[model samples]
Target: MDFQNSLAFAKELDANDPLARYRDEFLYPQVNGKDVIYFTGNSLGLQPKRTKKYVDDVMKDWHELAVEGHFYAEKPWWDYHERLATDLAKVVGAKEKEISVMNTLTVNLHLLMVSFYRPEGKRIKILCEEKAFPSDQYMLQSQARFHGLDPNEVLVEVKKRKGEHFWRTEDILDKINEVGEELALVLMGGVNYYNGQVLDMKTITKAGKEVGAFVGWDLAHGVGNIALELHDWDVDFAAWCSYKYMNSGPGNASGIYVHEHYLGKKDIPRFEGWWGTKKETRFLMQPEFDPIETADAWQLSNPPILSIAPYLASLELFDEVGMEALIDKQKRIVAYLEFILGEIDKQVESTFEIITPKDRGCQLSVFLHGEGRSLFDYLMKNGVITDWREPNVIRLAPAPFYCSYTDMYNFGQILKEGILNK
Candidate 1:
């Protein structure tokens, strides 16, 4: 489809969008009596209109049923987390039994590390991408320290070269082979947070496996933003937060995936909890932990029904829209944004450069050369909800579910005006 940087053309695209009705499903913050062009779905998604009702239903269950809500509520609290597994499996491209909704992203990463990041003897190093999310960096450092190893020596990073903004697949694979003998784990973000570069997870995972290293992914940005095949790619394990593209509210529950090969392996080390025990005999209170036979074995506590409710509501929309339709719209919206930005570049002597790679998701990170934070502030004052990174990058995302093509055109206009005025 050809893209045009005009309001009429943008509206035409919106008119033909099959998922246009979904914009009405969410509530956006108002700016001067109009909805702001929100482009920060890469950070926090807009709230779904049905989220309140979902929360209220859980509140009502607690008020009326109290403790009995565990087993007798409309959707029993005892197994509430289980409700999301099948839908999440479809989103992540895995077997239903291979996925589970559990604790927050980092906590689940730590739990999975206990089972997968087994550094021993000569193979104690961990490989990862450079400039990872701070939380992931801290987790990796602490995990290495837990095994009495120096983080400087144990951690290896795949960095961008001289003037490059992204890592090459061949360089990454070559690094995996170079560190083959000593590498114990290969943990990376499926999509880079700052630049929105979608890494080739399948090839990377295969390279790590060939070197006999455990491979995992932090899919915080990858989960709902991109199409994935964790099972088909033979990923050892993966974890992600629900608040970003999943639109489950801030600090919501997370989802995890473990390959079927590790399903019933009792020998795998994990921090066992009663909730992870086999449900049939869970009430018996057996002294020894008898783990479940699937990915649910990693669960440490009972489901947080209220916190998980919004995710269920959002998941219904995902299931209704489906990945095929969602991605089709995603590509179109991204292409339109690129086209509009390119026109802005040609019209003005702009200092900004789009550093995001071609293989990307909804986000496009703009590097403001020698510019200060004032340009970003101007956009904020003018009602463009984008994310500002330190130094000088503004990350914007036009989420397919809620953002219209007109939003992209307006953002490009505002951005052009801001740059020129500054």
Candidate 2:
């Protein structure tokens, strides 16, 4: 498809877009009384218009049912989180029994590590991408320290080839083979937050398992943005926040997936609490811990109903337009965005270096050569909401759900003006 850098062309594309109507479902931030072209969905998604009603229903139930809300509310607060399981599973490509919505991303990662990251005497090292998200780095470091091992000795990172911005699959597989018997775990972000490169999870997971390592993904950027089959990939465990592409509110609840192999197993070592027990036997208040026959076994406390409400609201959208349709629009829209960037780059004196590789989702991390922070400032002031990384890189994620072709064309025009003005 030939993309043009004109409003008419953009509108033509938008007119034909099957997902165009869904854009109005979200509420965007305004700049100068106009909706900003939101390009930061990788960081925080726009609030779905239906979200208010979801939260309001929860509040009303809490007001009316009081102490009995757990059992008497329309959705029933006791089983509210359960409502998210089926649709959430569909979004992430996992069985309902393999998915559980619970704590925040890092918290769930820590809890899952207790069950998956068992380091024996010879197999203690963990492999991750070099310079992972700081939170993940901190989590891995602390986990090693908690287990009485030097983090430097226990955490091995697969570095990108010198002068390359993205990691190569061969390099990761080679490192896994090199770590060999010492590799106890292989855990990394499924989609790199910096370069927006989608890792080959299936190949990597296979290699990790062949080396006797437990493989897991921190799918903070991968979930809802890219295609994932955690169950079919044989991933031992995984966790992701709901705020990014999932469109749950800020710092909302998280979801996790554990392979069916571990479900209903009493021998697996996991930190247990009342919520992890079987619901039927939960009120029985028996002393013994009876784990749920699903991924819910990892849950600790009762879920936060308010937080899960927005999540359920967002999942409704995902259900209405499945991931397959979303991905179709994602590919075309991102391609159009890239075309607009290239067209603008040709017209402007400044150079635009896109660091995000072809194996990416929606995000395009471009390095603005011969430009500075002021360019980013100019964009924000002009209503092009984007994410600025260190130096001169700006991360633009044209989320397929709400971002339109016109937003791409308009952003190109705004970008050229910013560069020419400089």
Candidate 3:
């Protein structure tokens, strides 16, 4: 993990990395004449090299099979949605019947809220972290308004007690009990986007369940990037986009999880369409909605095959190297990153802090205590492609699939120079 001493030391660590072969799987960025050290995986993951084939397979089917592609093409478009369910389930730690690949993240969130957030007279409040993704906040607000309740009255955010960098487990559980019968759902990010802090999802879900509230998660930054056990965790539901850590290009399709126990509850309504109907009876052109039980019942339409193709391609790489192994590799690489960044922090005169939790996934958020934007721009000019969040944070992620220790070492050097020079 001692890759911070010099560029040579960093190169040596990269040489010994077991996951080094994965660096060649995706396209790398170039700034000026050299490859830029990209640390923005938490925002947008690099594209897999096999994406073209994945897209082209669908394209080829469209060209030759034309309308017949729905039933006749290779991997038949008719049942194509089901094909991804098994692997997608593996990605999120759910059973095949508990997962479905469809819809964007925000859309899925709203759909899920419609089915789960049925608040009674006074039991209308939702418990979430205050600084949640804006989409989540907006969805909660809109849902509360739609239910004829003011957001201020119904939405309850679990604030950090006093002034703490992160939320406490006891504080959240206490709030859950304080709200008790009033709480409708407990939803939060699996890992926060800005700070890269992996929240205790299993415990939170259990706490929510204990208080008779549904539980869900937004794993936009967590899926494929960290280890999850939604089935084992007994989570009620969850949604996540594939573009971030799943490495499925920009704005890829997302997936959902529903615990298997819920499949038998026919009374629970869903925003449904033909695609979610049972495959055997779907094309029968029937009238009554005999909803296909299981997670696929949540689907509202046919998947955007073009958008989903790259996800399939990206998933293949993960299937080859299972999530456990990937997570193991991430720990090693991120530990290396933390060791280097920590040492660089000591040499600099300017105040710099790693706001991200030490045990987080590969991503780390650096707080420029004094100079923020100017230093960020300086790093960009020096061939480092990390992104700057508003205020004073630069989120760096040395993704396991494509990043090397040398890449992080180079980034630390440029980042240090950027701070010192500024």
Output the number of the lDDT-best candidate.
Answer: 2
Error (Å) of candidate 1 at residue 74 is 0.5
Best-to-worst TM-score order: 2, 1, 3
Cα displacement (angstroms), candidate 1, residue 106, comes to 0.8
Candidate 3 local lDDT, 1-422, one digit each (tens): 33446778878877877778887888878888887787888888898899999889999999999989998988787678787887888888999999988889999988888788898877789999968999999999999999899999998888875755667778888889999998999988888887888888888899999989999999998898988999999998999998988888787788889898777466786776887778789879898676787788888888888888888888889899889888887998788888877778888977777877664887888777878588888888878888888898888888888888787777778878887777
Per-residue alpha-carbon lDDT of candidate 1 for residues 277-296, written as tens digits (9 for 90 to 100): 99998999999888888899
RMSD of each: 0.9, 0.6, 1.4
Taking the tens digit of each residue's C-alpha lDDT, what string does model 2 give over 1-422?
87788999999999999999999999999998999999999999999999999999999988888979999988998888989999988888899999999999999999999999998898999999999999999999999999999999999999999899999999999999999999999999999999999999999999999999999999999889998988898999999999999999999999999999999999999999999999999999999999999999999999999988999999999999999999999999999999999999889888989999999999999999999999999999999999999888999999999999999999999999988887
**lDDT scores for all predictions?**
0.92, 0.95, 0.85
Taking all chains together, each candidate's TM-score versus the true structure is 0.98, 0.99, 0.97
Stretch of 10 with least lDDT, candidate 3: 1-10
Question: Cα lDDT for residue 235, model 1?
Answer: 97
| lDDT score for candidate 2 against the true structure | 0.95
Question: For candidate 1, what is the TM-score?
Answer: 0.98
Best by TM-score: 2
